[model samples]
Target: MSALILTSVLGVVLLYLGLSGNKSILAPTAIVGLVAAGVMSWTGWNPGLMEFPTMLKFDQMSTLFNCAMIAVTVLLFLFGIDYYRRMEENVAEHYALMVFSLTGALILTSYTNLLMLFLGIEILSIPLYILAGGKKRSYRSSEASFKYFLLGSFATAFFLMGIALIYGVTASFDLAVIGQKVQAAPNNVLFLLGAFFVSIALSFKVGAVPFHFWSPDVYEGAPTLVTAFMATVVKTAAFAGFYRFLQMTAMPPALSDTLLVITILTLFLGNVVAMRQSQFKRLMAYSSIAHTGFLLMAVLANSAMSWSTLFYYTFTYALATVGLFIVLTLAKRAANGNEAIVIFRGLFRANPWLALVTMLLLLSLAGIPLTAGFVAKYQVFMLAIGAGFIKTAVFAVFMALVGIYYYVLVIREAFTPAEETPVLVVSPINWLVVSACGVAVVAFALWPVLVG
Candidate 1:
């Protein structure tokens, strides 16, 4: 609770700093506050306590996810220092919006009530709608923001309707009470419908196939930094909430079958479509959707180790994504913001170290052996097979192979010689971030227990 309050206050403080014309210290201030909030979250670790009339639960799982979110946000803010260097106006608001969005993420990790869940989703999403349009002068940005708002609103309606149906049946919005009701009447039609609705809403939130049509355009149109935030922190929060809800409910077999179908479709569509993408951001958008499929598989397995597996997978994935997007930003600038896959050609010749780090990040995403991505993917597959989803696991493996083809395609471009020298503007901080993420991916792979 203190951590939540602290993060909310930090957002307000950042807003005040923006209003006060002290823009220089805004990033530093936000960073310090996030660190403090992270520490506060640890202090509550394993407390097994509930706050606000049982609306939020402070447990080891929540604490771990909160800390991971904070860690990723810190890295992003560090990158933002360079990414936002030339933007003279509204810098502080950008930092504040992220902090506000993060406060919602913290809530998502801990929420124990349906009301809190809805609030958390809103808090996490509203800011993103504005941030998506941060590049206000761009038509694509405006279109992205509007499309997101419309689709997100529809999803939220489904979520609320599901909650209402569950509340009608359970006579409470509390997860524990709802769980008791669900267990008591597992075969209730309204209950199954409610769960199905909730699942569809979350599927949309995580960009699963059939619900993922909005992601590529939005990712391509939004500012790169905002896209990174959506891909990492926002996705993490959505999955956390998703896993939490599923863990609470006694999932009906019908809902499980639905999830199975969605997972297969997501894996197939995300990987197969990414093969033909020429735009770099669009490719990554599809890549993000592909990863969502893997994460959903973990949820389907629903083992005792599910949370730990998810935490490790998301943490490592976020690290690689943040690094790759930073590289992409630099590459985009070098190519005059073209965002073409060909821009990466001759990256090795221009700067071998940067190219190498980028390669490691991409390889991790590709699930190459001896990297964090491989460990993450291997764990998911083992869990799926253990849960008796052998055929699904086999299909997922094929999709992963397709994923590798595209990732290696980009790697080949990076290693190949370019027709002309690409002018990349490398900031020291960005290089440090990319290097750190690359090393962390390798380090975690070698010592998976450390993350757990």
Candidate 2:
């Protein structure tokens, strides 16, 4: 796709531009490039690479995902303008690495071959390992980078082994051929084992439970921007790949049972554990895991509306998450880098508009009515019920209700009084992102056409 080529090229351009020692131009340049990439994706002008039918095809889902990833990245780079202003070096590297990671993500959404999937996952991940450690001076950042690298490496091994096993069975790595083989031998133990192993690797990528231990530590330790990128764009791509892999190829009954267990455990652990977290980022981390359970449910439903439901859920969740992280950044600064939820104390008094926007974003995340999050969850529940997963759907509802308490805790803190409330200073760009996210959620919900 032209957008894919453009993003890959843009990352390199940023690197070369970084050499000129004029750091001021990086974010704007990157944002402009991202916008152009997004335009190319949306317009359906995927020139070049048409001959490689077995490799990639930018169909509706992939194109939609590509555009969505590009759009969120534009938002991140916009925030990067302020986030990196105080940094001395490597600002361009940050922008460039994110673009490169995005390049891999685009590939993941479109890849038709297992080899391409492996390539895409590596391309998407290698940059993140570095970005997590971008804050070189922080020990926690170094720890995050190292921990993520080690665990991710292990996951990759499992993924590759699974691919090999599947190849061994089918004598091909092409998804279409593999699909045919899977149906030909539905009860083939080796194929199911391969699928199960692959599922574990993907679950690790998306932060699903049992494979989710790394998310909170990583989210809390990595630079918030990188964490936001992981939580949003990386997630969107991973789930899309996951749904495409399982659904398009036809999920085996054995694999469905395994996912059923995973979804329940992910729901139980993610919500129950989040209540114990006092740190803001850690809470968001577990909140993201809880969301993983919901997204897993969407994937499991495997209905005609599954992908649409997944995209809507992830995209809206991304908006809320990005805005909340910006809010957290501003609050953290005001509190002299304290990451506790207490940093938000008196936010309503210190900056009423920012605080109000914070409340709205939290509400959306908590699945409150009239917000996009609520609609997203409702759609998932309906889809699940329609698919005859009523027991699982009901359990999910209870967990969702459990999840709301933590979000409300943050919202309450924002609205509460403090003797020494940190004086948050929101930059206009940050404020705009926060307010826009808040409005977009409500706007998306009130409009019946979009919701329907």
Off by over 4 Å in 2: 48-51, 449-452
Compose the digit string of candidate 2's lDDT tens values, residues 1-452: 88988999999999999999999899989999999999999997756644477988888888888888898888888888899988989998999999999999999999899999889999999999999999999999999999999999999999999999888888998998899888888888888888888899999999999999889999988999999999999999999888888864588788999999999999999999999999999999999999999999999999878988998898889989999999999999998899999889999989999888888889899899999999999999999999899999999999999999999999999989989877777789988888888898889777666656
- lDDT per residue as tens, model 1, 254-278: 8889999999999999999999999
List CA RMSD, all candidates.
1.8, 1.1
TM of each candidate vs. truth: 0.97, 0.98
The lDDT values for all models are: 0.91, 0.91
Error of 1 at 107 (Å): 0.9
Look at candidate 2 and give me any clashing residue pairs.
Answer: none
